[model samples]
Target: MTDHHPDPAAPQPGAAAPQSACPADWDPLASQRRPEDPPLDVLLSGTVFFDIVFTGLDRLPEPGEELWSKGLGSSPGGIANLAVAAARLGLRTGLVAGFGDDAYADWMWHTMSEEEGIDLSASKRFPDFHSALTCSIAAQGDRAMVTHGHDSPEPMSRLVQHAPAARAAVVDLAGETDWWGRFTSGDTKVFADIGFDETGRWDPADLAPLAHCHAFTPNAVEAMNYTRTESPDRAVRAIAELVPLAVVTDGVDGSYAIDQTTGEEAFCPAVPVTAIDTTGAGDVFAAALVLGTLAEWPLEQRLKFGSLCSALAVQQFGGSLAAPGWGDIVDWWGSLSTAAQAGDLRAGYTRGPYMFLDDIVPDHPVQGRRRAQGTFAMRSDAGHH
Candidate 1:
């Protein structure tokens, strides 16, 4: 794909490298389509978890110690983070997930389908099953989490028959094999993510899904641990050999990605922001990455946009609600000085053999540039910060 974002001032030795063209009929802000909806921009499949988060912890608690938190909020989490993020960014997004008949499931379905405008026609509500639960304890820049729930045998788990058609899908590398075949119809793209192997398995066989994926994203730790590499750069390079694109996100430091197809690489510097809770920042990043790719953006723009999205999510509480929309992005953009908006914000990991990035904040020419409109509509009734 050709880079939608071009830097006129820079000297790109081989910027002449071929890139894919933008999608023929994609529009960022057209009216949202409903049932028998047009093909979706992105589709996601994973178990939906009800997230309960606690913040303001001085340190992790001892086994016998009681802990008190200064903040608390709950929302649908797990892959729901990506779903909401994609919807808020104005992608025609859909999800194939499973839930239970309990109140938690009802709330999740309502929040996703009604509030966030995500398509869940392919989702299932299990009468006998209970939705998954995640307890997040956030401190410093990272969070520790514990999850509990049994696997749902519902149809959503088996995605081959239930998943809706979309241009791309975000799925776990360990997910069912059939999903790999089901979603990649015509020109569909598959973006793969990974889950931790508690058993220390980290088996190569787990990477089977990569065979069908166009890109793979993993956190620094997950990337290093899975690839047995010492750093995120080496891991990304190693994984790129398996797929057309590879990215490894290092929290606070920034992120790195390589498009083997175009021989284009970028190491984006994270925008400086005070983080409140980082429970689902990775999911937010992945969602934004999916959006940038669907828009056929330059590799640098894609990474920078993902970093900004993840940074914004960390500033808010709750999982899905924390995912920022176009309004939030524009609001942040409006806060920057003209130079900051037009020049590169060099505040993150910098060592690499790739081109330096300028225009860390992208332009908003086609969409209305009203700074006041940056307040996202998906915010809660209280207008959560």
Candidate 2:
């Protein structure tokens, strides 16, 4: 069997790698196709909780100034949102993380174990730690967040010790890095999503353990931070050196991917849509990409599915609330594709108008517009600063 390898050196943009029309003798697909449903076992192994979002009508008040909320509510957040999105897409999902001994934790567990199809057997209950939460101020559908909580790191040995059947593990790097080394040594496919906190940012060094990951999905800012590069193309190139596949999402600017196996890069243009709330757009994209890959869809199709899912997420406030199920996404994709063909480029779909406590703020600026469109662009415009 011949080993598949990618060029270690960077290829000039637009330069094509040599192509092979036929599969090698040792290609995994050399055997006959199996007639079984694609395995749905996926572990969303990381932070879990509800986000307590508070949105205001205008810019946040000065330190001593009091302000009223336009809206407020609690919803699933962090890896919990990712897991729910995966479950909604028909994956047999599980979560491996810690939750507090608070009412929010109860809500989180019930939602995962009862309302959703996720297995919560591995979740550790901590009595002292606060359940993760995020508070946001909304202006014209865009939001600024203030979040708190510490994600307890689960040991890789403990995770592997449970030994449930799974095809892949989605790691949200909000926990300890040591477990990463152990997690990646197994044969299961590995994918990672980055998270940030108030006093710290996700360090690229933490990703070194996942040197041969099946895929790395990072929004443009995270990608730039990982690569230490100013240019998006350069960041993509740098990340390809560490992982087999790297996807860099730049909001409305679209997304790009580098195939480590072939040293080929593909671009997925963002589906043009008006967005209401921009939360959870990246998580939705990650879940959709995983589903598409599991379905063996082509690379471009996988990105298209992911991008469409993200578009739907921004149409509403909060992360998980805005996520569309697989069926809804398929329908939306069909409509978008048809619209694209007809040159009605601006027609798109969104998922939410869900009410929140913060929506009560008097004179709030986001009353009628979607936030995802311009907010992410503005937030990421600095490109990793």
Top candidate (lDDT): 1
Residues 74-165 of candidate 2: C-alpha lDDT, one tens digit per residue:
56777777876676555556676777777777766654554444666555676777787766677766666787877464454365345354
Model 2 vs. true fold: TM: 0.70
Please report, as a residue range, the 10-residue window in candidate 2 with the lowest summed lDDT: 17-26
Q: How many backbone clashes does candidate 1 have?
A: 5
lDDT of 1 by residue, 210-319 (tens): 87789999888888888889998998988898889899999888898999877899898786788887767888899888877876678987898788788878878887
Global CA lDDT computed for model 2: 0.59
TM-scores, all models, native as reference: 0.77, 0.70
The true-structure Cα RMSD of candidate 2 reads: 15.3
Question: What are the root-mean-square deviations of the candidates from the true structure over C-alphas?
Answer: 10.1, 15.3
